[model samples]
Target: MTPLVSVYIPTRNRSALLRRAIDSVLAQTYPEIEVLICDEASTDDTAEVVADYARRHPGKFTYLRNETPQGACRARNRCIEQAIGTYVTGLDDDDLFHPQRIECLVDIYRRHSPSFACSRFKYFQDPAQIERLREHRYSETELARADKLTLPALLYANLAGNQVLTELSRMRELGGFDESMPSWQDYDMWIRLADRYGTAVCTRQLLSFVDDDRSRARIRNSSRRAEGSERFIAKHARLMNADQKRNHRNIQYVMNRQRPSLGEIARNISLGGYKSTLKVLLHKFFGVAIG
Candidate 1:
């Protein structure tokens, strides 16, 4: 029997882009899949677009709307609460999944049986100007072999994408995504999953066309992210090693660097120096290595 996979999307006021995301899921090569769109009180025609899909596709699509604007993590949690599939994955509202993503991810999950499986993805300035890049470069041979996702690696940076496919049972056991965090909620979940079960990267590029638009830019610029980063560190500090702790403290510094404290900078450099600072930056932005 084919295991069902649920693709959940959480959105707020991005009806145009959300349409494309929904269409991408609808076009998936995989058949035994369902789509759950959690609209976070979008003030646009998000509901109408979702209704159209549900009407056309019948049982294949599910839509849940929030009464008021909650954050993306909360919206996803709500979707997870309702999903009936054995496996669950996610897509950002402004991103597109490759046609083979669902099929390939499910196959990998069956083979590895890890807590979750993720793949490499890249960004583009415009959603339409998409192109394949050799940035992540993982071979099928490599992806077939299971590798552990360690706490130190996550402390250095979050190597996994938002596009991870995880077992529904594990997600429910972990209590789903952290709703309090305004950012890095996915990263936090990945770390917790890795610590308890284990995680693997599929190496295949299964997602693409991540739009670097103003909405994402605004969230990145929010002061709430810094607070969230600090909260992540405080919550996970005890699980880290000396080097990981230094790197995490450096991450805290990077998240709130505009107020640049001389003492914090000096402390990070004194502990890790140029190499450590560079690792932190690469982990923060590019997600290079550490996987």
Candidate 2:
């Protein structure tokens, strides 16, 4: 039997983009899917758009509009709770899934039996002009195979998108996305899920992330990123090893401009040796970029 995949889209005020997202799901090669649209109290015609889809598609579409504007995490959790599918994934309102995305992901799950699976995806600026796609290319070339990700790697960066297809049961057991986080909620969820059951990545570009040109600003917004990273680190600090802690602190320093404590530096040096620790310190104080 085919598995049912639930694609939940948590959106607010992006009705035009939301239609594109919904259409992508509807156009998936995989037939067994339920598209859940969690509207965060959109004042626009989001309701009408969703209602029209419901009328046309019948059972394929599910809609829930919040009375007030809850954040993305809460909206996602609300939709996930109501989803009736064997596996589930999320799609940002501004993104699009390739035609074979669900079909490929579901096949990977069945064949590899991974707890959750993610694939490399491209990031493009504008979909309207297909020629402009070549102008800006953002693709994942790392993890070209199904390798188990380490906490250290994930601690430093979010290697995958929020569109990872995970088993509904596993997600619930791990406790869904951290609702308190204003950002990096997807990264936090990936760490927790990977830490528990291990993570595998498919070396295929099955999704397209429409970079709204907001990522740079979001990255530069040190406070928001730092707060979310701090929360994630605090929650999983006990499980992290010395190297992981050092990397986590390094990220904190880089993003938040918060200097690492003397004790932290000493611990990192003792564990990682002088050369690496010195390099990190130089990057921290001298503004040298750490790759």
Candidate 3:
């Protein structure tokens, strides 16, 4: 029998945190679901931890360990390739899901029949910070409209959250995640899906317990962020239309002025290309130029 949902987790060296993420899925009230974990060549004992869980759960949990260190995007793609379920959902290694997360999302998808769906998330620092978690409101009807799901809005606020579910076939059709992006991979995927299939259906606060730790705080440290943004803009420049691209270029111009340290500039430059680094230096020294 085909499972109702496949919860895909792409993890690296965060063994202890990964266990919590897995446990959250296992604790879900939704029964007809399988946990698919792709371990991206973690040097830590992540394999051993997953092995322990597999021994106990058997067929319910499927774990794949990679010998090579492909980033999270590739790991996610691997999970999609291995998954066998009617619907697919993603769970970050450090995030948690409410027991009803899958069930709620599945219900919304069935009712609306969207190509993709996302629910609101609550942010927290740790288990102890659960009390401090703040819920953000999102309108289902508003999100269903294309005008409201612009690229600028997406860039300003990553409203997609981590808990997104879509039909397995649609995911494959869209080529899963963009492997080239080291950061904002999810953002890029969402843009593609939105452009192809309209805005994602919102399911309110189904997923919960998003941890905003030092790692998340350092997302800007990604050596590929600026390059990824540029690449994303270039790849989807047409979709934004001429006007939207102009507006986005203006936003990028402003952002370049308020840039981070030289070290960050150097790192991103190395990761992206010398040309990109030169652009950054030019923007820093000479001010924003529309490219």
Best by TM-score: 1
Instruction: Name every residue pair that clashes in candidate 2.
Output: none
Judging by lDDT, tell me the better candidate of 1 and 3. 1
What local lDDT score does residue 94 receive in model 3, on the 0 to 100 scale?
89
Over the stretch 1-291, how does candidate 2's per-residue lDDT look in tens digits?
988998889988889989888887887778999988899999999999999999999898889989899888888888898899999999988787776677777776776776577777666655765234323433334223355455555655666766688888777887788888867788878878777886555545434455554544443355777788788778888777777667666666656544576677666653433344665687657766543
Please state the error at residue 188 of candidate 2 in Å: 1.8
Leading candidate by lDDT: 1
The sequence of per-residue lDDT tens digits that candidate 3 reaches over residues 71-186 is 88888898899999999989989888766667667767776766577767776766765533323233555333321344444533356765578888888998999887766688
Those runs of model 2 whose alpha carbons end farther than 4 Å from true positions after fitting are 128-145, 150-152, 215-222, 257-291
For residue 10, model 1's alpha carbon misses the true position, in angstroms, by 1.2
Candidate 3 all-Cα RMSD: 7.8
TM-score of each: 0.84, 0.80, 0.76
Mind giving the per-residue lDDT tens digits that candidate 1 earns over 72-128? 888898889999999999988988877766766777778777667776666667554
Order of models, best lDDT first: 1, 2, 3
* Clash number by candidate, in order: 0, 0, 0
